[model samples]
Target: MIQRFLAPHRTVAAGMLGRLARRAAVCALAFGIAGAHAQETSSIVIKGKDGWLFPGWGSLTQVDVRGIDNTTRLIGQARDLLAARGIKLEVLLLPDKTLFYEDRLPDGQTLSPEVKARYGLILCKLGQAGISTFDDAAVLRQLKASGQEVFYRTDQHWTQASADATAEAMARMIGRDVAKLDGRPGTGMTLGPLFNERRYGDLAELFLTADEKKQVGREVYSVRRQAESSNLVDDAPAPVHVTGHSMVQPYFGFPQKLSSLIGRPVSVNWNPGNVGPWIVLLEYVESPAFRQQRPQVLVWQMFEPTFAQGPDASGLWDNASIMSANAWLDRLKTALSH
Candidate 1:
């Protein structure tokens, strides 16, 4: 009697259950496919030509471009402030890694036309403002043409050779004034033994997986150490001072080589490149180091990307470090008065 009572609806219920199962399976398959695609696309690393890896999100964004005029104005204002203190300001704008390695970029990635013109535009704007600028692009291109690696395959920083070349250029500029002051011809200085080391680049470490790190390998650089010279002393309060990013650090052999080439001891005060240039300059201005050993010429080295963006681009820097263009100029003026 129970079977007869349910038998009429049992067939209809079974049909409905079978259709629902089929629909659930289809939905699951679609979601599974989408999830896999999203995982692949969200990876931070992209494979580049010849086993190189590029950061998927490393390029400059709209915010950086929007802030260029403001950044440039601040730089010019800094020059004016330093000029008031009777100190010379030399702006060294290091070109982006992509500038030298565009051919090795990851597949489907292209440097925008605006980025291609960024360095030249920066130089032009700075020159128009009468700020002393270094032509790093021309020098790097010349080195690259001569088969010297201007930048590492996986790193955002320049090679030791490129750093040395930049130092040499700085030495030439600084040497001229020193020669004029001392009433002597500029002497040809020398560097010591070559030191070799194997290292991983910051970008490589940031983007590569363990397997990729092993596969892509590390870059070896033979850095030049400062030689024991009769003329140069280590402890003197040198007239030339360098303040910038990691590029000017002693590890990269920039200051040492710069000292060797200029025939005099040099001083360097630098920080990690990410802290932004405005903070570095402002802090240096207010520090006891600046008060005790003021430099006759200060070399401010910075990368193009960082130079393009205003201080608050990442919002990672402190309030004391980040401010508007006008505010920064006012602060610079205040710092100079003290």
Candidate 2:
């Protein structure tokens, strides 16, 4: 009797209808979002340069033609300007943290050497300009080989230890002895904005194991000197100046670390910008307050993507001071002589 009642129309008709409607809705969304993929040879067969399978969906967007063409001119101008200001400028293009973890590309596809070379060319061009750049990939690989980790696997920024290594490298790049750089002694009292505020926890969750976040922010950040000739005495003065991205700010104790290298408390102009990082960096260094610092060593930290975008096409902020960057360059030139 039950079979006869169910067999009147079909089995599980309502359940099947719900599933079909849901699938159709999802497909409609995919078609709406990635309409370009609608031109596939088959209803479900889409092909790419390497028989690339889209699996459930395809990326219909086209690659933009713009990339790193004018980095040289902009960097050359900034370097010349900074040099005139009597600063020793060093540029370090931090590698995309995703490049190493293989997060950007599809699974099972190894990052090709061509991709790496494309990444490396930015540094190569900087070298051609007679500007010193720290090779992040090389340094990261070396540190890993030495049983010392440089980056958190998931985060896009460096670990404090990595930041320390970077400070040392910057000192060497500026012809200053790395031994002079020192880590700030921890306050041994309380933590700073990082832990107290819980900023960057999402990104940190990717790179840090459970143990790494414990070391994120500190107060004193004291360090025992490793460089015999560079040890900090009881009352040494901080250094002239430091300028870079959020990476070099004192909260991570980068200023103190660099001061240890330079045998003083390193002043800094670190602004994390919504505009391009270089413009932000350039604007800060050229500012009157920052200008007064009179640093001999100027540390510039940017990522590979900055080289890709370059300065010619940079998004200028409404308040961007690049208009006067030229005059600042002239001032910097005079500083270089001092």
Per-candidate TM vs. native?
Answer: 0.77, 0.56
Q: lDDT per residue, candidate 1, 1-338, as tens digits?
A: 01000000011145643553344334334323111110112234557788665544335222233355456666766776787797888888888777777788766777665556667766665665566877899999999999998877776667889988898887787755344322122332355788898877776777778887877888886776555552443244556677787777766777767756665556666666557677777666666667776677888887775565567655434455677766666766776677
- Model 1, runs deviating above 4 Å: 1-47, 54-66, 175-190, 229-234, 314-320
Best by lDDT: 1
Tell me how candidate 1 scores on lDDT: 0.63
Estimate the TM-score for candidate 1.
0.77
lDDT of 2: 0.45
Index of the highest-TM-score prediction: 1
Over the stretch 297-323, how does candidate 2's per-residue lDDT look in tens digits?
A: 656676663444434332332344233
Q: How much is the lDDT of residue 254 in candidate 1?
A: 79
Off by over 4 Å in 2: 1-67, 103-112, 176-200, 204-240, 311-338
